[model samples]
Target: MTLDLSALPPRRGRLAARPPAVPPGPPGAPGLRRLGLDPERDGLVLLPDGPGPFPLVVMLHGAGGVADGAVRLIAAAAERHGAAILAPESRDPRSWDLVRGGRCGPDVAFLDRALAATFAWLPVRAERIALAGFSDGGSYALSLGLANGDLFAAVLAFSPGFVAPPDYVGSPLVVVTHGSEDAVLPVTSCGRRVAASLDHAGYRLAYHEFAGGHVVPPDLADAALAAFLAD
Candidate 1:
């Protein structure tokens, strides 16, 4: 089914003047799975013990990434910043639309639903919302976040490979982190290339290179979360 990704919650900034989202193909068409994700039920939504209106970080997992471990890894940092975590499972259990980009697919539709559900029932500060992810998810975050800049004021990409945005939208601030010793998606190629491109495009970007591999340290996650939740 084609989901209405329009009607995003209102925010305080002027959105970019971009056309509406068009399905590059059938909205829910399935493709071959390459990386495979662990079984995820709906999206794992984690909120602090109590809250009125909290910042929200829409987190995406790596390729075939574990849901429990992924959320547990970042939940503490997000909570420390009084932010809610909306961890949506890609419709595909293997990977995200990062392979192609957010043109049209079931994963994008699922994201539309996830955002709608979050805003409908959760206490989210629409203006403070962000799109973040790790590995493949991180790459996808860069693509989708830039495409929906008005909706997501900030974007946090951790150890990303590349970005594929079919079109561009409003300009949003971005925070990118990569492991200098990353073997899967090496920092020299993946992270550096993406960061350079985003910088060239004139988007407000913060790029960080750590001395590790394809992993998100708590400190890195905390830093990204803090920046995502900041004003």
Candidate 2:
């Protein structure tokens, strides 16, 4: 068989597309459900109790696990702040796309679908939406949030390694947190480099270096949640 690489379509970043319109979930539906194209993976969406166009934080989990305890903690905090939290697993069970591949691939599509579902099912304050993640997921969030800044108003990256995007978009507010004692990703190489690049690019950032290892402190999570909800 003759090979014709040229016949294949070019590998390019896909523009965000709107998902099919659907009404909000049933009033008493379970908070977390298995929906969307990928049924094996599930996402958690917590809507505020009362009527509200609430702020939202779309979170991406670290490499290796499902949504972590910090995600649940953030959800609880968001509930108090009247904000909503949506956390989706990566298509690749092991790690996010940006961690394995440089730029976005199928993960971004999953995120777009999740975002669409979130908006359709909840009353979101579109102006206050933020994208947040930790570790490899943090790297992916930075890349995606930068590429789709018109949709994400802010980005919360915790201990991210690098931000690799084929293109750039609007300037969204950013917050980064890294532990000086982190051994998994290392503070000097990953966090500092990412923060410096974002700053050099003229993006607004609030960075914090704590005295811990590869863990998200409750206080730091609170700070990040505050940053995401700030006006």
Candidate 3:
């Protein structure tokens, strides 16, 4: 079933939420505008650089992870690749799991608003949007990409383990990489498991295993991470 990206239907009869506050940029220095997709719930700081209609990369952070180092590093990496980024800070510093199978927080609706808000404010090409995430953020990317397949052209997941929502209709190009020796999330059960599910579903997927564990490899290209993104 092909998805229609032109319109984002509200889930459960709810409107898109507003984006969170844009981080202040060097007091008075020209910086990113606080672009709100949904009010205070989901949003990314629009750090506008070169010009308009550029590719947008929406980033999600790790579990028990704040919008701090992990997010900043991922954003920096995307910027180096000449892509604009929107790093959404998760509501809980712990997990994206909504109280053990109940959908109550992280406010999925807010994420929808975040994307819409960026499209409206940033000079980003709507169809060129990419989704990337680390740890918990990666899980969100997996889940959201499946749910809103048409919204993202590609999905990049780093150290991602699990994504709920058993059935995925939209087939966004997927790139999943994990460390063979990962102990923090058990690659055998987590990354490998999810990869298998995607594979069984016949989706366009790229799965990679690194020598290291639980950390983003600095040389992702050598591990074919770049190739996945390029495809």
Candidate 4:
């Protein structure tokens, strides 16, 4: 179903739709499928190998990255934990709207549509939804997750540069991972600063710094998913 932007609040970064009470039955078959929401830059969804009201993670791709690669980062871990993945392509070719415009706009709207479609097509646990991303995508995830915490129960940002939410909403659990030797966006100025800000804002945050470059380690990705799906 197409999302009605007018039905959503007039806020800069707010999403309107929530999970439906009685979702249309006959969920999609297990495996990956293109959302076909947009013709040029459609998104992708990966379902686990069993019938379940599985946990969901909405993943975002970094600048110049696509949904296909972003979904692969956590595909193995998600399969192991029986979670579903919804990776949406950004409206902008370079990065998310929030990163480019300093406020959420088209990307937010597209993501809302993507989530609405995913909820309708999958057996998802309403309370087990999380937002996660890498690099610029990570920053977008943090910003959008904070703005729509009512929808996302947790956020996992990998090597995010900053957090600039148009507005804050509910309080969701947050996990941030960064490399100490990140050349693109340094740890001290980026990840550390972001963690400090979240902590000062009284948000529950788990920050981890590793010795590497701008990349999400497999172990850390697994751990982040574990924390996100934990009871």
Highest TM-score among the candidates is held by which one? 4
Candidate ordering by lDDT (highest first): 4, 2, 1, 3
lDDT of 3: 0.62
lDDT of 1: 0.72
CA lDDT for candidate 4 = 0.89
- Per-residue lDDT tens digits of candidate 3, residues 22-121? 4212222224445544353344454545554556667777776644444464554555555667766655556664323445334464565566555545
**TM, every model:** 0.80, 0.85, 0.76, 0.95
Q: Give the CA lDDT, 0 to 100, for residue 125 in model 4.
A: 85
Candidate number that wins on lDDT, 3 or 4: 4
- Runs of candidate 2 with Cα error greater than 4 angstroms are 1-37, 68-70
Q: What's the TM for model 2?
A: 0.85
lDDT by residue (tens digit), candidate 1, 50-108: 53466778888888874555577688788678777778776666788545443446666
Better of 2 and 3 by lDDT: 2
Candidate 1 Cα outliers beyond 4 Å, as residue runs = 1-41, 100-103
RMSD of each: 9.2, 5.8, 6.7, 1.8
Question: What's the residue-level lDDT of 206 in candidate 1?
Answer: 88
Per-residue alpha-carbon lDDT of candidate 2 for residues 1-231, written as tens digits (9 for 90 to 100): 732322333234433533224435443432554335466766777656665566778888888767544367466667667777788888888888768876567776676666766666576666788888888878888988888787788998888888886668888999999999999999999999999999999999999999998777778877887877773
- Specify the poorest-scoring 10-residue window by lDDT in model 2: 2-11
The global C-alpha lDDT for each of the candidates, from Candidate 1 onward, is 0.72, 0.74, 0.62, 0.89
> Pick by lDDT: which candidate is best?
4
